[model samples]
Target chain A: MTDAIPEFKKTEATKVGITGSALTAGIGSATRKEIAIILAVAVLVIGGLEFVLWAYDVPQYILPRPSLIAAALVKEFPLLLPHLGYSMVSLLSGFTIGAVTGMVMAAIVTQYPLVEKVVTPYILVLVTTPMLALVPLLILRFGFGYTPRIIAVALAVGPMVMINAATGFRRTDSAKLALARSYGASTLQIFWKIRAPMALPMILVGLMIGSIFGLLTTVGAEMVGGGFGLGNRLTTYSSMINMPEFFAVILLLSIIGILIYVIFFLIGKKWASWET
Target chain B: MVVKLAVRNAGKRYDDLEALKGCSFDVADKTIVSIVGPSGCGKTTLLWSMSGLHSLTSGQVDLDGERITAPRPEIGLVFQEANLLPWRNLMDNILFPFEVKHQTPDMAWITHLMDRVGLTGFEKRMPRELSGGMQQRGAIVRALSLRPQVLLMDEPFGALDAFTREEMNRLVEEIWLETKTTIVFITHSIEEAIFLSDRVIVLTKRPGRVHADYPVNLPRPRSLETMAGREVFDLMNKIKADIYGMSSMRPRSAAE
Candidate 1:
């Protein structure tokens, strides 16, 4: 029994050593491998489509080849640039307004449970409403201008940000709180020093979700109302039977979505690197 | 010697369940006192009460003749878990309590504390990056960072493996000797209590009171070899009997 003690302890120490050594900056080779896989799949799909379309002499109206889409993208760049600018303005401004309000609401709710009780039902009701269905109402209330488009984006994005931020604020470790109290730390000190940094992962999660939701709503709102966004360009090109240009607009929107995710990914790596 | 902390008939009740009926003890200044009991014996209740983290239902706990109403800056606590904030690195974690009190840290003292605990070069490492033993070591130093007059440790090494647990005992003993802080050590291990403390105070089951107070007459600066001595064995037997032998035999009296 006594002889087994040394072996038992050695194994335990080794377990700790392994866990301790594994604090990699989460954006390690795993992330690199994932990005590689995504690029490889994109190349294989696009290259295969281009090859099939070239060999079979498929119609441009049916499904344009990768080369045709690339050409259309280059040719229509001048017209698409203005629409892209409009969509970006609505997306960025609405996301900023919504995400900031969500975080602020999260902080206020965390400090006062009574405020949370009053606000939560309205948030839940708004969260369940679809972004597409709200455009008609938004247009009716605010007219066919930037206000309606921006409000649509904010409505779609706000709930996700608020939920994640609240979760992050509330999930602080009780042991850390006790330790702080034992040292006679004030409530404000504990909130800023211990709780805020610990909640960074959740707050950043809110931002990522809000960004995607903003992109979707901005495009959907523009498509519904038909004025000046990538979505509006989709309507115009399709009406004119410009399939290649329409596809190019879709590709641009997809790239913008990917770029949004990439920005959040980099921010998470830099700030909440301690998580993994 | 002056009495540093006195727990006078402290009682705690949670709704109907009485965790402690009446517990009384006095710890001398600069001495190590260990409270030992069986599981569910309200050992933690008494410890929390003494540390001013929890209020007693009956009596009061005094620190240097002053009543402890709430957590004071002069008292430090070490929980079973290291409880180091995972987001913070080693240096920031240790500096936390000092920063909370708005006091500038003594760089030499902090560096020395880290060096002695074998965590000198690992200051920049996050809590998760350190081994369990190293994390606990960091927690110990964090608790002691503000130079509290009394240190209350609630089974600080309970989660550690046997080998590391002994090493922690050595580290704590060395620190206590160097800085003669009044320490209230709570644990369930008989050997651990006798090994580290100057006096071992044993408690009964729920509604816990002072069942026995045995002064360990062991030699100073004791080591692993001290466990085998006749005096240590005799004391351990008495404590074991007081805990297991009597409590189990009179089970009905315990719940009352």
Candidate 2:
């Protein structure tokens, strides 16, 4: 038994060393591999699609080739820039307002059960009512400009953020709360110090979901009423049967959606990196 | 010795379930008292009441003659499983109590405390980076940072391996000797109670009541060799028999 002690210690030391080294050393290579795989997959899919379109001699009206879409993207890039800027402004502003209010609503409701009871039904109705349906009514009230589109985006995003952030705020570890209480932490102190940090990852997840919803609502509102944005360009190009430019608008919107996901992911990585 | 901490007829009920029933005990100044009992005997509930984290349905806990209605600054608690904040590094966690009170921590004293607990170099490391024993040591250092008049620990080493638990036992003894702060420790281990405490208080299962209290006459700074001696075993047997006897009589008592 006495002899076994040193051996156990030796093994434990080695195990700790291996894991410690792995954590610091493995990250760069792991991320490199992740990027490599993504690039390889993109190459295979895009190359294969381009070849298939060319081999079948698919016409632009039927389905444009990848090369034609690429040409349209580059040639029409200057024309698309202003519309892209317009869509981005509406998407970001609405998402920011919606997400911030959602967090505030989460805090208020979690703190006061009565407020949650009174507000939750309307939130549920808003969430399930297909928010884009209100765009025409908003336009009729506010006119065919940024106001209706932004409001539609906010309505789509708000409920998702509120529900998610509330769940995160309430899901704190009971033991941690007990520790804080044992030290006589006040309700506000508990909320700020303990609950806020613990809820961060979930809150970020809510924002990510909210941003995506906001993006979709922005596009939908543009399609229904707005005379600007990539969604409007998409309708205009499709009406003229300019399929390459239509696909180009689709590509731009998809890129914006990807950018939204990447932004939230990076923020989550930086702030909510601590494992629960 | 004058009483440093006192519990008077404490009773607690969670709706219909009574966790503690008129439980009472006292610890004199600068002495360690271990509360031992069978499973579900409300040892933790009693400790929480003492810490003022939970209120008793009846009676109160007094620290230096002051009734503990809320968690007092003079008292600190070490919970089971270390309970270190995962988001904070060791140093930040140790200084949390000071942060809560809006007071600047005396860094020199905290640094000294960390050194004593063998957590000197790991101050900047997150809780996840450390082993279980290391995390518990950090927890201990955090509790001791404020120099509380009384320190309450609830099964602080219950989750550790036997070897690590024994090492922690020695660390606790060393801390108690150095600080001479009154301590109320709760555990189910009879040997642990006899090894570290001045007195062992046993409780009956469910709606816990103090079943017995045994004064340990073991000499100070007890080593593992000392714990292996005959006298320790004799006390262990005595407590064991008392617990077994209680279990045997439980059915009859329940019928009444």
Candidate 3:
């Protein structure tokens, strides 16, 4: 009895030790060295782009010289800050509203049968097609103000969140659900305990998508008619043929977009890393 | 022994497919009963029906005279896979049933069960951070922690190797002797069935019905040496011949 028992325990202990160390090693964010390498590569790309433009001396309208754009960025820095802030408010607000409504709808459908019928058809039709075409109608209704623009952002962003989150809710393991049921957990308890955590990876995916779509739609909204924003600057400077300022605004918009993706990427590593 | 769990004329149909037909059996209190049959023989269906995880198309399953319709807290089930939640560590996973039931966890009991299953120090480890055998050990101890009146195991060690399977059988035997929890284990291995069970219930192939029931009448604390005994070999051969449909090989008593 003692012979087999000790050997089994020793082998089992070693097996667990290897896997436990492997888990901590494999999970979480990039290492500090890796982060440094990424940062260095980004600097090289930006500097190389600037150097190429300087060497070429291209005409400003076709493509503003990097020096000019940077100077425009510096000159317009104070001015661009307010406009950038405006676009962010709409993007963040609209994304939040869409995400909240989408998750709420998903929760409702996963819980109740009838609510899915009411919500899914409308969300699917709107989500699958470009809702930007409907922006003109919204503009007509809401008068080119913050109302139409934010509403447009919500319409564009909400459905992906709703669809993915609902799908995620459905993807829970039947065995786990059975375990929960055998323990006499209520439907609400199962939703919170089993369904919700399992649905998180999908929900994060939805948010990542929603944030990207929100940026595009909000920019489209600003282009259509906004009092102040990077998109508004794009229209103003281009029409006036202020190439450097126009190019500078585009640069700022790209930076903000990259920042949103990085945020979600880190979040994915933190929470959903175990999925692999 | 008194009847603890009873399946009465239980039948199951999935749409057009009938998986079980008129299957009936009774498990005596505190005894280990094993069900073995050919593949796709509704052994799982019968077990699931008894667990109240699936609704039977006809007839009823009862636990201590009460009809089992839905999942009850005292009815514990061990699936073939450990099925531990990946996001939770071993401690949380073991404590999950109590958390769901809103009952305070008996920490002492959980630790004791974990020690019994040789998982005492791995409590803080995540499911993904454990080996397959370790994970299954944690799962078995979890099933035990529920302090269930009857534990229904569906091929609990089916995925393990021969050596690990033997270890698990021994672990289960020790737990049963110590706790006296009625267990209805389903398996495909005839040797395993004969070795672990007080009585073995053999079933007919798909649309399964009870084919035969034989009491082991073997002594307690049985070991691997028991499998080498002539009586055990004769029992295994008889059960195997029945399962394989070699009717000519059915055991005739030496006297007869």
Candidate 4:
């Protein structure tokens, strides 16, 4: 009887273990199938582009061959690195300043009706006026160094961030606001805890858009004024008729923009997925 | 217990339209008070004024012996809708008041409250992931987590199905029994008011004033059985008659 009891218990345990393993395997297989489909799609798209490039004798000047761009990238690493660093510094600094100031302004505008009314028209004007047009004025005022580029980037990006953040802050549910008030939440606490978290996904979107604009403005300003950065190199290359180097800088800028977008996208997925 | 809330000649107006006029009532401590009326009877406005969420156009609201100027931590409010913060998970939503007030939530109390509400093991889930009943359960947990001395609920569980609403009514009765928190719950359902309240306050249409205040002498630890009894049915009919009779006297638009 003792031996039978032990044997039966062992059999039950093994059955349960096998069932658990099967369930895990089923989930894993499903996930793997999805990933495989995505990877196959990506490879096919990239391969099709390569075939087109090979079939049509597309000139290097119009669009450098991917392999040729790769070669240029490998060859120009040292030269690109410092310029990349400079652009990154300018982008990060300007983006940080613009985002913080925009948030503060949005908070003020949201809290005070008079401030919102006063700022709305100005924001609308800024939105309508192109940032590129103001770059020359910034350069004239701040000179041809990093200052003009940073200021230009900040000016170009601030309104978008401010508008998006303010909308997010203002769009909180009245019911939740009433609930918060009923719990005796102070204005600052309501802003920080309820309004801020609720606004995060929208704010991140603003940040992403702002960063892209900041980078673009930095490069645009650099191009407009003579500088020692990648934008300046692009201007020099174009003036000297150096197509390969010009294409290389363009590739670098595209990669930077994509990187900024991907980073913020991942953050939105990880932190704000609850929004769905 | 002494009177915890007193409303004396309290009135609220929105420009030309008066919502409540000369509304007066007193609620004893450690008791549940239900305010019942038709849709536009200003029951919600009265609760909002009591919790200091809305300003009184005339007269005053007193909590204990002191006058209420603004929302105090001592008063907790629950709306008809769950209104759980979507970005926050269940536990975080419950803990929101603490985070907002810069006070550390009592974890033991939160856990106990969650257990009572049957929300255990669902703490990490977002409000959207839960069913309507579950979301309302989370909202209740959130309100109770603050341990407020006075609880003001406006049509809480009004969105629930009949069965779920009945279940929640019992759950609320149990919580009130244990906590002894002074509760003023607003509902248009006469049966709900009778089942859950120590006293039921009825109001008339726009420029609402108390039409009747009936003390429900139902026994403690009320259950589904309490709802089925003769006294409960009698009280429910009386409240219905009071509401329908008063509402019928007014013009169509004004009645609504």
lDDT per residue for candidate 3 within A1-276, as digits (tens), equals 113322234445434433343222333446799989989998888788778877887677888777788899999989989888888888888888989998888877877668887877888898877766777888788886677778878888888898889988878699899888888889889988888988887888888888889998888888877577778889999999999999898888888888887787767656654454
Each model's TM-score? 0.90, 0.91, 0.87, 0.85
Give the deviation of candidate 1 from the true structure as CA RMSD: 4.9
lDDT of 1 by residue, B82-198 (tens): 988877888999998888888899888888887777787778877767767888889988888778899999988888888888888878888998999999999878888998899
Task: Report the CAPRI category for model 2.
Answer: acceptable
Clashing pairs in 3: none
Sort by lDDT, top down from the best: 2, 1, 3, 4
* Per-residue C-alpha lDDT of model 4 across residues B160-241, encoded as one tens digit per residue: 8887787788888889988999999998778888889999998988889989999999887787787799988888888877
Report the lDDT tens digits of candidate 2 across residue range A100-198: 999999988987788888998998898788889998899999998899988888888888899889988878688899989888889888988899988
Candidate 1 clashing pairs, residues 3+ apart or interchain: none
lDDT of 3 by residue, B61-84 (tens): 999999999988778999887888
Ranking by DockQ: 1, 2, 3, 4
Best by TM-score: 2
- Span of 10 residues, lowest total lDDT, candidate 3 chain B: B244-253
Pick out the ten consecutive residues of candidate 2 chain B with the lowest summed lDDT: B246-255
Instruction: After superposing candidate 3 on the true structure, give the runs of residues whose Cα lies further than 4 Å from its correct spot.
Output: A1-40, A65-71, A110-122, B246-256
* Docking outcome class, model 3: acceptable
Q: What is the C-alpha RMSD of each candidate to the true structure, in Å?
A: 4.9, 4.8, 5.1, 8.2
Candidate 2 lDDT for residue A186: 90
Ranking by TM-score: 2, 1, 3, 4
